[model samples]
Target: MNMQIENNFSYHAPKPGQPEIYTAIREKAKELAYLIDEKAPNSREKSLAMTKLEEAVMWANAAVARN
Candidate 1:
C-alpha cells in the first residue's frame, strides 16, 4: 500500500449575503484612505481614488435613503 500527502485549497466562504450598508460604507472609506496614502495628492491615481470615494459615498447615501 502507498499513500501520498495532499495540499489543501479552499473556496468555502462563511459569510452570508446580507447587506450591512453602514458598515460597508465605513470599510470603503477606510480603503479610500489607504489608496489616498498610496497614491498621494494630485497624482492620476489620486484622481481615480477620489472618483471611487465619491461613488462609494453616493451609493451609501442611496442605501440610507432607501432605508
Candidate 2:
C-alpha cells in the first residue's frame, strides 16, 4: 500500500467574543486615523502625527489582547 502526504494550513481561530474586540479595534483605528493631523504644517510634523496614530492602533490592539 502507498501513502500520500498532505500539507496542512494553520487557522486563526479567534477566542470567544473576539468579534467584538475586532469591531472595537476597527473603530478605534478609524478614530485615530481621523484624529491624526492630515496637514501638520510640515512633512516632519505629518510624519510624527502618523507615527502617533500607528502607536495608538498598536496600543489599542494590545489592550484588547489583555482583556
Candidate 3:
C-alpha cells in the first residue's frame, strides 16, 4: 500500500513563564490529530499519529500542572 502524508506543522519554543503556550500546543495537536483521522481513519498511520497526539497532550498537561 502507498500512503501520502501531508503535514504543515510549525514549532515554536514555549516562552518562559507563559502558560498559554501549552494551550497553543494542545490546539495544534488537535488539528494534527484531526488531519490524521481524515487522511487515514483506521490504520497504522492514524494509530501513530494518535500516539504522538497523546504525547503532546501529556506534555501540555504537565506544563499546565507545573504552572
Highest lDDT: give the candidate number. Answer: 3
Better TM-score candidate (1, 2): 2
Supply candidate 3's per-residue lDDT for 6.
Answer: 18
Model 3 C-alpha lDDT per residue in residues 1-67, reported as the tens digit of each score: 2222111133334467556766777788888888888888697877987997898788676645543
Best by TM-score: 3
TM-scores for all predictions: 0.41, 0.50, 0.52
lDDT, candidate 3, residue 50? 98
Cα-lDDT of candidate 3: 0.68
Point out the higher-scoring one by lDDT: 2 or 3: 3
Which residue pairs of candidate 1 clash?
none
- Number of backbone collisions per candidate, in order? 0, 0, 0
Off by over 4 Å in 1: 1-41
